[model samples]
Target: MILEVATITLRSGNADEYVRVMPDAFPVLASTPGYIRHELHRGIERPDVFTLFVWWESVEAHNVNFRESDRFPRWRAVWGHLMEGAYVEHFAQVY
Candidate 1:
């Protein structure tokens, strides 16, 4: 399985609103091929920091199949206003 994590740092005071927006946008991503799961996590110690975990069966499944699809545009619009910046990482489960 391939895991993609996007660490999002909201522009202060917007974190709670940011978290609330995700589930509503999920249907756009969930319908894509090879999308195994989607999860969002917030930092307890750091606060206002979030990690969006996306489980895909393969990189190509995301890069090739999903990105070019129609859903990403609507997905982008969902939280486009609340974001500051994000860092993304692709990882494989080693444990």
Candidate 2:
């Protein structure tokens, strides 16, 4: 399995709106093939920052099944506006 982490920073005063809209956007991930699970974490010191951890069967499962699919656009349309900057990276277990 692979872990996909998205580091997102929202514009000032946008955090509440972003949280309100998140549930509606989650179904897109739930519908994706190879999607295992996800967790949303907010920064303790920096409220504007969020880290989303998503588990998938593989990197290809994420890149091909979700990122390349219609779900991506739909998901982006909902949350994209809230983000000031974001970056994604994939990781694997060491042991």
Candidate 3:
């Protein structure tokens, strides 16, 4: 399994806009092949910080396929303005 977490700090006063604008992109990614689940998490200690957790069958399933798709550019464009400091990482774990 592959889990990707994207942590973003929205520009001041743009949190609402960021949340409101994500639905347009989220559904597409959620429906992609190999997609398992996705969740938007709000930081407990930081209000402006948000994390997107995306689970996929494999890294290639999410990274290679999703990143190269046309929909990704659209998603990026939609959220570009609201993003201030963003960091994304992938992790693996054994259950």
Model 3 stretches astray by more than 4 angstroms:
none
Model 1 lDDT tens row, 60-84? 8787777788877888799868888
* Cα lDDT computed for each candidate against the true fold: 0.86, 0.95, 0.84
Q: After superposition, how far is residue 22 of candidate 1 from its true place, in Å?
A: 1.4
Give the runs in model 2 whose Cα sits over 4 Å from its true position: none
Error of 3 at 91 (Å): 1.4
Clashes of 3: 0
The TM-score that candidate 2 achieves is 0.97
Error of 2 at 32 (Å): 0.5
TM-score for each predicted model, relative to the true structure:
0.89, 0.97, 0.88
Q: Which has the higher lDDT value, candidate number 2 or candidate number 3?
A: 2
lDDT of 2 by residue, 8-76 (tens): 999999998999999999999989999999999999899999999999999999999999999999999
Please give the range of 10 consecutive residues that has the lowest summed lDDT in model 2.
12-21
Q: By lDDT, rank the candidates, best first.
A: 2, 1, 3
List, residue by residue over 5-90, the lDDT tens digit for candidate 3.
Answer: 99999887788888888888787787677889999987778878899999989888887778888767777888878889888888
Note the clash tally of each candidate: 0, 0, 0
